[model samples]
Target: MLPNYFNTKPLADYMRHDLNIPADREAGSLSAGRVGRIAALAAASSAAYAATGHLLALLALLPAPAPAEEGDEDRRTFWTDLRRASGASALLPANLRIGVVAALDGHGAGLATRLLGAFGGMSTDQRVATALLVGEHLTNGDDFPGPASTTGELWLRDVELTAWQIIHHHRRPPTRQAREQFREAWNRL
Candidate 1:
């Protein structure tokens, strides 16, 4: 359990107000239920991957509806909705998180990256909370059964690259070049 002094309100407010999560969502609440769920999801996803060695199968637990055609707008909508519904539960092990985001349509993937970027300036507690939320969202169970799509694999590569950017932003003091590059990428998206 987190220390009593580890405040989560700022992070929850950012997710709800800045990231645009619905005010009604439990993720936006200050209650321990939300934090507990985030921690539980992270621990569970980590344990599952350690035990099974099948990240793909674990990611498959999340709902990823296939597009009739690649890059379909409806599919993008599905991913966006999925992100909203799952909240910060989408951040899992690197392999699983990358797979889930890569499976999204371009717009959806862009949104995911944007959300990660938002974590760049937050406090450590907030970042931890955000990571937990994202991990849980992606690892949360669904009934869908199938391998990740070819497009998803290809997009996974891209997400991996962007995720590194997020890590750089979070782990170190920002550099001008890194900030500029991040802006350029966000603009392109």
Candidate 2:
């Protein structure tokens, strides 16, 4: 069984406190606002991923729809309605997306912690999975922590950018190649 405190706090706590360098930014380090945003984004993304996974599983049980013919307006309308029903939003600005990714690249654990918080509470297994996914996707392989330059930040920035891109792309009917790429990227983490 998990501890009560662990279940109540967002998963991001693990990453921020234990993973990130300086962990809690002091006066000269990163600002409170930046850290807070990263934490919040991470938490939100994690929750969304979990919820979406459940939703897709339920959807899979239903009968498959017929393939749309070329330029089928009805197909387009159906997707439009479906997306509207899903209610996912494009929340992060592009610049911030880049910055967060950069942070993840340099500090995978820190990034994962922020994301774990965003994901909210989960089983120990779930938390670990979420952390691994975020860390792998965001940083690729980079994992050094220190003062962040724009160059260094850009490397990590790809993770956030990829997340956003995935969310947006998933809304549409992805091609086989696209789906394969997405799965491969995710499986790597």
Candidate 3:
């Protein structure tokens, strides 16, 4: 069960912290120790995110957050909105929703899938961040709203479509069409 006071902001912090895992850094003789620490932190963050749903909500969820806005309330708010938007996208289809969030990490979709599998499930904060990325990317050249809840559907579609566009930006319409068709077929269940 989740902590009675858990909420979204700390959860988001945990998500960011987890994703910041220095997979590339050298794990010395303390490799096991390091991995354990990273995993624990990641798991905690994941759990927090899972508990809170979004950071703004997390602020209210956690029994008692730091008691200080940390002087970056605005930044936190932006991230919270991002998470909500991206998470909404993830609601589309398991594969595509996860795929878009993972893909935005600057690595390939395969890596994203692997990470998700390795982590098992995303914390609520993590989900929100993923949704936000997809949502922001898809809403290209448009203004995203503040605070209140918005639909993740638009974000989900936009992320998938944008990813397709990026991959086939240089190709002709036929190639793009084939890829889109394949994606649609795959997403159909």
Candidate 4:
């Protein structure tokens, strides 16, 4: 049986209620506005961008999530089953190659999408920091929001591999050192 807390809204409802998504916009039009921004990054990491965007759309179907408890270990290990079932890298960082790891639970994917939408209206440098934060939250370890689907499990690995890549490419810095500085500044923020 599915958990009572899972997100169960239709795309239109999700678009309306989602904090990051625009309520007035039609669901199909999401790809043109805020969500479109992420899609544009598909030029480089097509697989990653496509998978992450798909994952976000799937996640949007879920119900709103409960607040994560502080320092919740179960939350950190949330993606364990999906990771194993997909035969993805056991080393979280290896799957991400940057960081692994979210209170984010069911809401993480959607939040990440919104964060990419001009990164909460932040400056360019601040946006990179937002991506780094998204990578950390997504890879951090929380399991799936509710029960997993066969398709969800199957693509879990690909989602893990490229979600961050899509976010990273959105506001790519001129150099590695510059990106690092953004991370540092974001931490300060």
Candidate 5:
């Protein structure tokens, strides 16, 4: 369980309003799909690597799509809607991945704590994941901490200027090549 301070309205509201997830998502044993996918991917890669990837996905996507599995079962609604909404192809995944990566970089946990409050109630990985995904910004580009920058862009800014140079900034879509590129770009960043 999180401390009372972490139970603030803003954080809870972000989960409910933005992610549409229960604030207790981390406190639970984790959803079967979230756990199974992370376990399998971790087994394939290293626990550190797979765990990191999973956390970032939790942070960025709208409803936080489960990682792409073999059958593409998890990829259906989230990715499809994102593609249709964003008009991206395979590059969507790449941008999201890069956006998350750039957002985290060295400031991973620190950034998450600042945006999410009290870090991850029980899960430390999410301390960074939520930051990379949802991110913080000056609301209306205000640059002040009060209201503006509430919707701030973290990795979005860095990645756009540096890697890929996406003009409109695409994010969402799951292709093997995009996965590889996302990983590669993350490494380069």
Candidate 6:
């Protein structure tokens, strides 16, 4: 059976309020403005992670940046807004206890890691949620303009895979390879 937390309303409400999104914007509406789109995606991503502890649903919500933009600036803005919204929501006092995860990309992963790590007093669930968020963010290629380096991509894949194993596979521990790769990726960041 699905978990009750999968309801998504609370997550949507949290995003809308914390991100200062417009009241009329609906979380499920694709026609909304940029802020609304980001809010919707963040809410959906958070709910999907909390519900299934998997990254696919969250990844699928990412729309490719519109091609009409002249350069990478538009893509950068999209990722930046997404990272900002997710970071804000993740750090909220009320939402912190929900074990929220953010779907970050690129250097945003490093930023989220440092921010969450500095908290220093997070509960075990919070730590797990942060790790899962990092994994989900790293696994998403949409954040990158071009293909990521093979080694970096592989490391991210392992991180997400290990996180899933721990979250949904009866507490199976991360493999030695995954641990090593995660350390390497963290250091590179």
Which candidate number has the best lDDT?
A: 6
In order, what lDDT does every prediction score?
A: 0.40, 0.38, 0.39, 0.38, 0.38, 0.42
Whole-model lDDT for model 2 versus the true structure? Answer: 0.38
Candidate 3's residue-wise lDDT over 43-109, tens digit each? 6545322322222221222122122436655444554454354443323333333433333332232
User: What is the per-residue lDDT of model 4 for residues 44-135, given as tens digits with 9 covering 90 to 100?
Assistant: 33333344455455343322232346455553454443233223333232333222122022223433443233223454444344333334
* Model 6, runs deviating above 4 Å: 1-54, 64-70, 88-166, 173-189
Cα lDDT for residue 59, model 4?
41
Error of 6 at 87 (Å): 2.5
Q: Kindly list the per-residue Cα lDDT of model 5 for residues 1-189, writing each as its tens digit.
A: 111122133334434543355656674666777556544543432322322333454344334445556456644554554344333343245445544554344212222222232221314343243333334322323433442222324433332232222211122224556778999999997
- The TM-score values for the models, in the order shown, are 0.21, 0.19, 0.21, 0.23, 0.23, 0.21
- Residue lDDT tens for model 6, 22-95: 55566465345756656565654553334343332333333334344457664545544444434444333233
Q: Looking at model 2, which ten-residue stretch has the lowest summed lDDT? A: 1-10
Better of 4 and 6 by lDDT: 6
Give one digit per residue, the lDDT tens place, for model 1 in 1-189: 111122233333444443454445765565676566556534533321222222233334334555446666654554555344334334322223443443231112333354445334455555444334434444344522233333333333344454544333223234446778999999998
What is the C-alpha local distance difference test score of candidate 6? 0.42
Residue-by-residue lDDT tens digits, candidate 2, 1-189: 111122212334444543454344464565777667666645654543443333333223222333456565644454343323322111112212442343323312333333323334344454344334333333443553433333223432443443343344224234456768999999999
- Residue 157 in candidate 5, Cα distance off native in Å: 15
Residue 189 miss distance in model 3 (angstroms): 29
The better candidate by lDDT, 1 or 2, is 1
C-alpha lDDT (0 to 100) for residue 31 of candidate 4: 48
